[model samples]
Target: MRNFALLAAGALSLAAVATVAQGVEDPYIWLEEIEGTRALDQVKAWNKSTEELLAQDPKLASYQSRARAILDDEQQIATPDRIMGDLVANLWRDAKNPRGIWRVSPLAAYRAGKPAWRTIIDVDALGKSEKQSWVWHGADCLAPAYTRCLVSLSPGGTDADVVREFDLSSGKFVDGGFVVPESKNTAAWVDADTLLLVGDFGPDSLTASGYGRIAKLWKRGTPLSAATTVLEGTKTDVSVSPFARQDGDRRWTFLTRGKTFWTSDVSLLTKDGKVVKTPLPEDASFEDIIDGRLIAKLQSPLTVGGTTLPEGAIVAYGLADIEAGRSVAPELVMAPTKTQAIEEVAASENILWVKALDDVSGKLFALRRSDDGRWTQAATALPDNSTVRLLETAGKSDTAFAIVEGMLTPPTLYAVTASGTPAKVQSLPAKFDAATMTVEQKFATSKDGTRIPYFLVRKKGVSGAVPSLIHAYGGFRAAQTPGYLTGQPYRAGPLGMFWVEEGNAYVLANIRGGGEYGPEWHKSVLRENRQKSFDDLHAVAEDLIRTGVSAKGKIGISGRSNGGVLVGAALTQRPDLYSAVISGSPLHDMKRYSKLLAGASWVGEYGDPDVAGDWAFMSKYSPYQQLKPGVKYPAVFFYSSTKDDRVHPGHARKMAARLNEYGNRFYFHEYLEGGHSVGADHAEDAHRAALLMAYLKRELGGKK
Candidate 1:
């Protein structure tokens, strides 16, 4: 959704495709043609200019090396994507194998630091043989045996992917097996010869959000069109996808209809292939089947058979009772407090893993339910003040993997079970120089007096106002955590290694519209209130200046996708606040957001531009419409991928066109591939990040 995630994820103002009905004519509308000759020509022209300005720098190679060292570091843990009974599966990518390979290793040996490897699919080889630029999306394997799988592969890194059934044991794609043509598709294994699928059946089969609207159950030896329709949500629905979960002897199949970005409707798909509405509330998210019960996270307060679960509470309902249509009360598993937010929920055979953030710091807990239907939790002994994410979870056993890292700590992998015993599996070999850097948590008072939190990292003992960069994504319930600026390539993009090393203090703004404190924190700045997120960002920048960290025009702001909105707003709404901006795959043309692919899905977050009231507030901050002539703006470096099917590259193209028309100077680049992310591979990611870094350094003055 780069609304590129982590999509609190994921967009800018009401996302949509556009006809440019905003009274004013859009001269750059032709750029929305995506791959049109004229559009690509303009893109090439801008890309040429960009290379001269950024890539031509003598230090460009160094910037790229720093990025590759983090992205393609061979020493990086081979964190398993799934832990099979005695095997661990992962996708490995590097300088040589940029397209990556899906391979597996024995679990016992992997835990002990020795992995006897087995290759499943060599994506680089497959792509070469098939004459395609293949990118690994993921693989959904059948349960228990784990020998059969529906492997998804994307061409040119687009959201749409071609899914095929492969025999894991045979190390080959099954002859005449299930194959879904290139489309944003979903295929879940229901049984050995059956599947619950959502795909591009034909015209009008997809929703306005550019996702499948029909869910069907397809059996072996049947034409895909003959598959029985399981559920049909409206074309206006955000999306509709099939769901299947296997837990020991039980199987839970359901249909999930995403009504909006935040709320959805779930219905059970029974063994007899009948679709029945589940008793669970529509807004409640069915996370996974934990133990013998179906676990759900309540977005709003839900009343279940006499008891009401508070918003942001996790509860469990027995699968049998749910399937039998019996009146069943839910048991609360994890209830979030004001300062606590549930980050992720995963499960093993007996253990339910709940990764929560307590005051913006990572906290992992292993919650196990007793036979009496009571739940008890044990907090894992992972280092506090870091970001702890569950790297892999399995329904087969209690063995789960977690990764822990912080502003100064490199990511360390761990193996944990229901007993809350976490064994250090592998620790990141390299560490950022913490001795020279100082990390601190600071709060900026927003317009409404809310204390917005942010993390600042810089060289130790450096006094006075210095050049700096502020990065934030203040939309979607995505939380901004304390990330290693100088170590992790993800947190600060490529700037993590170079920018901080050059003495620029990097700031991460934990503004509203993020899950820092929970859903309420995000709800505070939605739609009409979205400007609060902008106000909150400006507040942080103002706080940095007022706190003697930097002066106006000395600081640079950057964000992508939804963060794209953040930087776009910062540029258009508060031009005097910063000197430079880096916005990638952004949502600038808010007026036409929904008309674009996936824009309709984000209406709940940004509001619908088609609706008058929604657009009334949306148009006010819609960056595209806010551009004015003669107003000095920080030179913005806008980068987007032409293959991006999520947030259209047109948003960036149009914004740049408008800026140029308004006599403002900006740098722009659009990759022929790379989808909505940095790029299709690390090389591309490094180059994209390098360009942004070069722009930031030049704008803010490279050295102290």
Candidate 2:
């Protein structure tokens, strides 16, 4: 409702800006009205232009067909995900079930090549029956028993979801069970009969970032309104949420008060409803409890209890020692190097698996505590230069599943044990022919002499003047690793297969403002240093051109979310470097972004625009504000979703509308659903991918 109101004002302001140029008024402010009839009609008109333009391209039809086929392919590996106690679950979507179906299989069946899956919930059927465009968010089942669960369903893939209590045994929604209506909410089970919830609780319940500020304990058979408030945070804070961590028979409930996007204050919720403050660095994260010890990963150097711990280090302290009010010495777990960073941490019953990145490649390590209270670490032997992700870990055993893959390699799942060798569980069949494609790790020097690493994928012995696509995301500590595309079964590496195999190339830039190196690397390009990331990207592009991999009018760049802003900045600042730009679900209007949906939360990463000092640098890189009337910008396309509640669709909408006013040759496509991504269903994703590839081909002169 806040966004809609802003859109209405922006629309009126856009109309007024053309006549009354009194102050800095937006000319396309009308487009911000996400679901307004007038704004949607305008979007329809612009979409028609894009449709007509793409219709004339000969490759569009073939690209769309190929994309749809890839997405809808039945042979695509059903990625095994463990949920509840023993059931291995998977959410599957194909041509037959576009909305996807949540299905479960036994552990034995899952480990085998083919799983005998039984449908737990058909999202498409539920959506049709309810006459709503319900998108599957996911389900959170209680540990151990795992009979009853909380299922989250979103309308058109928005961040806001309706949470309903579900009976896993009966494969049906629980009657008169706990249900939370659509709002940005989070919940965790305190017990089968109780839940800790954080969400919109009527007036004054949300923060400036539009996140929940109140935490409540709702017991079974009680109305949500009557739920007892256990904790509360100020409206200026980012959010407050509760999470229950179970270690064997011990269950620890915690409430995290997010003061900012990167920092939080953690408190332990006791059985008697008392809040006990945990002493730790505010920037440090409470990872998980292992061996009756609380673990923390520090983002900044901190002096805690007379000892200083460096940034990018994981440390642990005894939970009993803290409770007993005794002086405790923190145990050093892992400290990353200047060129390395911890990516993720997964804990089994006894061992802790740490996923770290040395440079930009993946490294897996396992840590275990011995009988003498000494911790030992061992590196897990997986494939080199491949991204390794922990699929799931059981609380009762020292067992987990890990999936490893690279840009050209297919995803292979492995059953990881505590001390033994990780055994192979499943490997996806080759989706694309990578025999001719070779991947090279290269580096480009930034303006400050920082050597930025990037991956280049191209055909062997074929080099000069190829149609290349450069990709990057340089913000929010989110490191862009070398994965097999953001790829799915049918939507396999179409870029690798359709584009690269068809004589094109792809380059992934690991620029600053990302966790490619570590917290230092990310912080180096934050706030005022944001331009360094843009500079780093340009350096990569310049390197590609200098190395003869691509030419000025032959390269295209694509990025979504933060990367959207990255490409958007590139298109504006260095328009001559690339021929095409695909900016999806982007943040182009930085000046007013803080006022938009969930935009205020990012002030920690991107400083507040209201601050004059912050605005000076932000305005320089803001793509929407940087557009000039006479600039010869290349074929730039902006795509977004109307259902996006996290980043807000208005960012793309206003930018495209602004581009139109400049008489620039650009393309705009906003899906009616699918939140902040390509879309909710495979068909929508296929169309989105097809549109991007087709546009890139048309602009960069790819083969028909």
Candidate 3:
């Protein structure tokens, strides 16, 4: 097998400099120029060629059979939305009570632990709302008591003024409401009574440049007169910490911002009205802040340690001078030297907990302050090799919870003791028993000899080929690993279907583009090595078919965001390998993606299309650019939101139009308000999951 590195080099060399010089053309232009008839013909030709290749490759045939077996097993239960919902419910249950759900926005809370203190709020009598959809954002909680909690409600999803607060104690809503008349408000809690809201001020308030000033802080009850300005407008970048903390006698807020392309700022806002901002070291961008003082800053041109980081070394940071209030220059700590990534960080006054990624597996570490005030580290926990997402923690308890799952293992919640022992706290409803389910790991050699890892989950008694769904995301150094299973209601129920109950789904951890194997793995397929990513996905598909998990005609693929881009590239490059594809809020037109908001910042990962060398590497797999003249792709579903300022919704809109014009069967659903996520409320999420699963069932052929 050729090494992935060698193959990436070879692929990069194949594209010509002249062709790469075209730069990023407006995707709208491509949509307008490419005649539907001509595009359809090109898609057909590509699909036919790929089918012929698979037919000739016996290995590919066998892998497809294995994939089918996994998908076809009849004994497994079906429940799509059940997974996510149950997972959330279980986490709430383990928190003991009064827990709230937090998400990515207001980066401060996300880092500080958006959900914040576990027992600080109320959690009883919680139920999903009917009118609102995509409830992930636009919600806040007030800690009325340990058993009494009040949750802010947004019925018009995340973008409208719709505001109502719920009393978890009595499972009813309180009457006082605040609705912004001219703009939409997304709420965040600064304290029980204070809200930090982000929203457009109104058309009249917008600048001449078509940009509007979105306020970052607003007091709920106190008059604006008493409030302080945290962030003034859109021009000044701001992000909140995931969690908040008190240092010495002051309450501190940590955030990162960029005033220009070359310089980024990380600052600490003290409660006493003083802002301490530090410029990132020249040529470096701050990724995240782990502990309050330990910062994860990436230098221009990101590089994983030449080797993968040792197990438990995923989170890297530069120590700052505690007393001096500044980062120590030229110092790197917890740097991984191999295929690993620091995923999460949790700390107390005396110790810090860090989670590291090794391929698709996870490891945890405990670092403590020494007598001399230095840090000492040691591996404290090693759960069964699987995918893990940290759930919650009790302050200074040294105890934490996580959701763990594997290909065959349904996701389940587990509590980790201070001693690091994992105790199963709750098991998702088992429509199928683990004893009857078979889960295994298999590797496929990439075009270059790099082994790509994948997992197969199926029923034990099932025989022969079955329809299968293969999920993958081979970009942005993200990894897909095993974890606890979400119930069928969350996974398939809302969709009027169920999991194995519906059929089988496979997860592929493709190589060269994820943190699974470390920085080296990601580098092998980044930018110029982009083709390697598509090939890695292709290799996994072939391996599944060869193993008899599924037949060529029974397979489907799904991904979101960058993962969505992976699906786009694969569909364009190897449509024969899948019967359907789901690309959600995907960054498909890579050549021009960076031009979007903050897109320029990611050049470190995706490469600059304007540069000759990089463009040569990107053009080969740039999904939109690679669409052929005569090919028929499997039915594809493209979903995005109009308010998604992060990755422009234009990507999906253009791709959908292009595919439709080409006479291909595809579905396009754009939400008008939910921001980046198409769903805004619980009901919205349930509906979206249903739609996605329904589409998969229709294309993949589920429980008849």
Model 2 off-target regions past 4 Å? 1-17, 20-24, 304-307, 322-329, 485-493, 702-704
In model 2, the Cα lDDT at residue 459 comes to 81
Candidate lDDT scores, in order, read 0.82, 0.81, 0.52
Winner by TM-score between candidate 3 and candidate 2:
2
Q: Candidate 1: misplaced stretches above 4 Å? A: 1-24, 304-307, 394-397, 486-492, 702-704
Candidate 2 achieves a global lDDT of 0.81
**lDDT of each residue in 131-185, candidate 1, tens digit only:** 9999999998877788899999999999999999999999999999998889999
User: lDDT tens digits, residues 416-511, model 2?
Assistant: 777747778778777677788898899999888989898888787784679888888899998888877536112222654567777888888899
- In TM-score terms, candidate 3 sits at 0.66
RMSD (Cα, Å) of candidate 3? 11.3
Candidate 1 positional error at 389, Å: 0.4
| Residue 671 C-alpha lDDT in model 3 | 61
| TM-score of decoy 2 | 0.94
